[model samples]
Target: MQKLLYLLILIFFSTVAVAQDEDRELLRGTVLYLNSVVTGENVINANTRKATITNNAGQFEMLVKKGDTLVFSAVNYKFKSVVVTQDILDKRRMVVEVKEKVTELDEVVVTPESKERFLELEKEKYKKYDYERDQYTRLQNYATNSGTFYNGINFVNIFNALRGKKKKDQRNNEPLKVSQFLREMYEDEFFVVDLGIPQEDIGKFLFFCDDKIKPADIAGENREFKLLEFLVDQSIAYKKIPKE
Candidate 1:
């Protein structure tokens, strides 16, 4: 609902209303009860059905002619109406008012989306991003009750790697894109400080992180917290790798 300031019928005149149509002209207006501007209210002309909304400044412009009725409506505001008259047409600009209903926003429920679903969504959004070489990277996931989750090959990812046809579709830029996207989401501190993955080894560490879970799977989604959780847990397993 818009803010309410019980206002007297305010009739003001500015430059003549701009009538673009043979019969209609442009009418500028403001929706404010006091001196403060109201936001998010729709102002509509009932006769012509032309519409505009009160912006941050509570100002709007719409096409209008004499005898057209202007209606103001919003989620929290009581309906207010005014009619365009000859005097209003001469003025071109006017200020009006709306009364607010004492109410609150409706409740919203939030739930986490499945990682696979997020992956599918990102794939659709970045469909232009070619994923090349199903033959290149083998992947496996092993569930765990404690310590770091280890991805063990049980055969599925092996088949993926063996699929020769998948190689033809692989985009050469996907690996680079994956790294770039990760770098963009995470600051250097996340790699060097939080994960204890050195700046020099960050690139290799991301390669290691791709074994079980790839950030590319959910690239567009703003689920950085989920990525953070995965990275923290994955670093433990990464550290276990013997330094060459």
Candidate 2:
């Protein structure tokens, strides 16, 4: 009878301790932009400072507790914070919508001369910068000068060439800078796991994508989605190439 009493006492204490413990649970959620998945965004627990990033499907999971504050942050998206509550904990899944930081101007007036000049610049790019070499000469010249870019123009790779090296060196290495930018932008798993390019072949696959379309062509514009789409297509093409 004493042993039975002691066992029940232990069980009661264990239940009390469990009931008093903090309600920490894994919360799963998707981030959406234009109703499409927004990958690579950050999900942070403001309380614990633990964090995780969204995957390709915009899904993310992180340990959150009741009353914990969750922070959502990413480039080109507005910063957001949410307070964890009983309902959120019970549901354990959420959908977060992030508003793009880009602002739409209500009205803009364009002068005829400016419009003509823009069109003229568009036409001049083909003749101005040699397309076959991907404008090596222009890039070399721009080593000390930040060149101008216009719409519908390709091969204006100012995003790369971070440091102004000597003209000869810049000319030789400027083209590879686009691939470098891409490499720095994403983790290796993006190429291997997400894109399905083999771990050893990431460099080769990036080069293949660069050759198809200069990933840096759309400078000063939101390029994440386009870059992801392009890489997906290129990865498909890359897998088809016969290996030695």
Candidate 3:
């Protein structure tokens, strides 16, 4: 009888162990936009390890075991990762909030005429400086023309030539400097737009500019002109107010 009781006790302990393991299993909560709508819906499941898209509102609920890692990702937003904790597991539901991404604009402008002139001068400078022989010429030229140029034709010409030569050399020889060389290494990347033109007229310019200009060109021109118009409109609106 004692042996029989011992066997039963062992069986009972085994069952309890299995139950504990099952309870400790991980769960995941995914947040996605439902039906492409911004309203979020969470799909909750504990037994399976899988990724589920959130509803349109970007909310999801899943059952996860302690120590399981949950990854949150969506288009245009930064990706995030969180490890499940005891507090999270204890909760009946978890709420994940995603913030909208904001893209900042650079205030500098680059005009088509200036771009052409800059490139032309850049080519001339490359030949003059012997950039093909001296690799450091490009880096040096970029450092010299790192800011806006509003006045003095001689300075602009000299600066642009050096910048162009350096940029060409870097593109041919070095791969790491390409992004910086394109963005900050040359002054030709930016153009200034003439703001005296009317906003209605600007639309016409865009249509004409399309054949000759790329998206980057449009953005540079539009951003500068829009900023100018916005400022002018604000000024005019304020002038109409009676002195207080």
Candidate 4:
């Protein structure tokens, strides 16, 4: 009889609890930023049956049932969702915090062939003009003012070529063509460099010879071409012939 009474009491409480749960009404709350800012109004609606946006004061209300999910969304912020339980439904109001999302753009790349072609055309158009000498002089001055990275041998040869001084010894010793030079540079450096500055900034002032030196033909040499590869990769210089 004692065991029977105990079982009866357990059954009665369970039924009462079920009845109470069924009688409970859904409650709604508005979503807002942690700072209490109202990003938008009326963003939430009923097909999202249990959701609604906050008003100007960042306040909103909705009907929610036990176990229903409420979602909040805005154009400027990431969407958020939370589940409503019996304890939460008892509250007169609820506040949800939303966070914003951020996006980043990819790096832009300029092609070496196009840049080289542009420089070549410019050089051809200006080669015989007196103005071209001034341009070359300015570039040489800039290079000289910058500390020498390789004993100035490369710049000396380049300057001589620009000045039309083709000493036989220098001709024989001319540093490899720009393409070859790039390949050599790349072989030595483990990383690449960006050389996408405007042609006027570096092109008119730097080496502009195209036919005199082609990169594609010289990339096959086994010597260190780290800097050369870096230049080619960065689009500062290009191989006239495509590498196989």
The TM-score of candidate 3 is 0.27
Model 4 regions more than 4 Å off: 1-28, 41-51, 105-244
Off by over 4 Å in 1: 1-20, 104-244
CA shift of 160, model 2, Å: 52
Q: Which sequence of candidate numbers ranks them by TM-score, best first?
A: 2, 1, 4, 3
Predicted candidate 2 versus true structure: per-residue lDDT over 1-244, tens digit per residue: 9999999999998886565444578889999986789999999988777789999999999878889999999987899998988898899998899988755564332222234443334345435644434422333333423444433222234454533333547446444455655664556765665566778999987777666775445354444345545666667678889999
* Candidate lDDT values, in order: 0.59, 0.66, 0.43, 0.47
TM of each candidate vs. truth: 0.34, 0.36, 0.27, 0.30
Error of 2 at 156 (Å): 41
| Candidate 1 lDDT over residue span 26-55, tens digit each | 889999854568998899888866688999
* lDDT, residue 228, candidate 4: 33
User: Model 3 over residues 1-244: C-alpha lDDT tens digits?
Assistant: 9999999999998897677557764443434321233343323233344456675455455546776666665554445666778887776455555443445464323322344443444345444644323432234433333443221122233345544666776556532221232222223212112222334443343333333323232122223333223323433333355655
TM-score head-to-head 3 vs 4, winner: 4
Candidate 2 global CA lDDT score = 0.66
lDDT score for residue 61 of model 2: 95
